[model samples]
Target: MSKKENAAPTTHTSESLFGKVNYTWMLIGLAVIALGLLLMAGGNSSDPAVFDQKEVYSSTRITIAPLLILAGLAIEVVAIFKKPKA
Candidate 1:
């Protein structure tokens, strides 16, 4: 007996811009969020003595917030631009 060939395309449709494989981009977003939270919380906390608002002002918050925001934005862009897959 001969085997019948399939008619439908085996490949799936592309949903986003890059592709479904680009899911890792979302992880980056999560990492950024965690990092920002950590940094904001860390706030130059070298020793577990105490946490002061003044210290927070001079803490990594300066670095963390921007990084998190930027990373979040980038992830969003990737998610939007990337395609689902073929």
Candidate 2:
């Protein structure tokens, strides 16, 4: 048989890649935003209306906020690049 006649069969799936949004990415983005907000909230805000304000972090702990934020952003970006596990 000629090589052309023995070509591998290609299966066509009845779906478009752009048809759906990857929920994993949406979840990751939400988690990241939440974490970043939480980290930023760790420190005391200058609003008395915002009660339940306790300083769980200090000048030294301030580093944690940025770290968590950066980590969250990184995770979100990775999720975006990853294919949906389904």
Candidate 3:
């Protein structure tokens, strides 16, 4: 046999790091995180002298926003670790 005939053929396959579903989940998580950040922002008073304790310490900003952020982070972790479908 010739040297060329003895050599094995090489095949190339292209693949993505993340699947469609994984990307979708990642997007959802990002949206949730953005929402949390938006909720956490904007406690500024119109007047420099006036400080609104209620607005600054609202339950939504203090409690819900952090929870949403944490939940989004957890979702992101799950998405990253999830197995892609063959």
Candidate 4:
């Protein structure tokens, strides 16, 4: 037999690093982070001279936004670590 005939044919398959579920989770995390950022932004006064401490230091900005951002980061970690189904 010739050398080429003796060698078995090989097939290569391309696969994604992450599955659909992981991508979905990542998207969710991104959305959550974006929401947190939006919530944390914009305490601007109409006059620009006046600084509203209450608006800048509101519970949503100080507490909720940060918490949401943390939660989103955690979700991203989980998504990165999650195993894809075979």
Computed on alpha carbons, the lDDT of every model, listed in order, comes to 0.69, 0.64, 0.92, 0.92
TM-score of each: 0.51, 0.46, 0.81, 0.81
The sequence of per-residue lDDT tens digits that candidate 4 reaches over residues 1-86 is: 89999999999998999999999999999999999999999556777788778888899999999999999999999999999999
Clashes of 3: 0
lDDT rank order: 4, 3, 1, 2
Question: Which parts of model 2 are misplaced by more than 4 Å?
Answer: 1-22, 43-61
RMSD of each: 6.4, 8.6, 2.9, 2.6
The true-structure Cα RMSD of candidate 1 reads: 6.4
Clashing pairs in 3: none
Q: Per-residue alpha-carbon lDDT of model 1 for 1-86, expressed as tens digits?
A: 33445455479785545554566777677777777777776534676687666677754677757778788878867776777766
lDDT of 2 by residue, 17-84 (tens): 42135556657677876876686666546775765424544543477667767777776676667665
**Superposition TM-score, candidate 2 onto the true structure:** 0.46
| Number of the top-ranking candidate, with lDDT as the measure | 4
Better of 1 and 2 by lDDT: 1
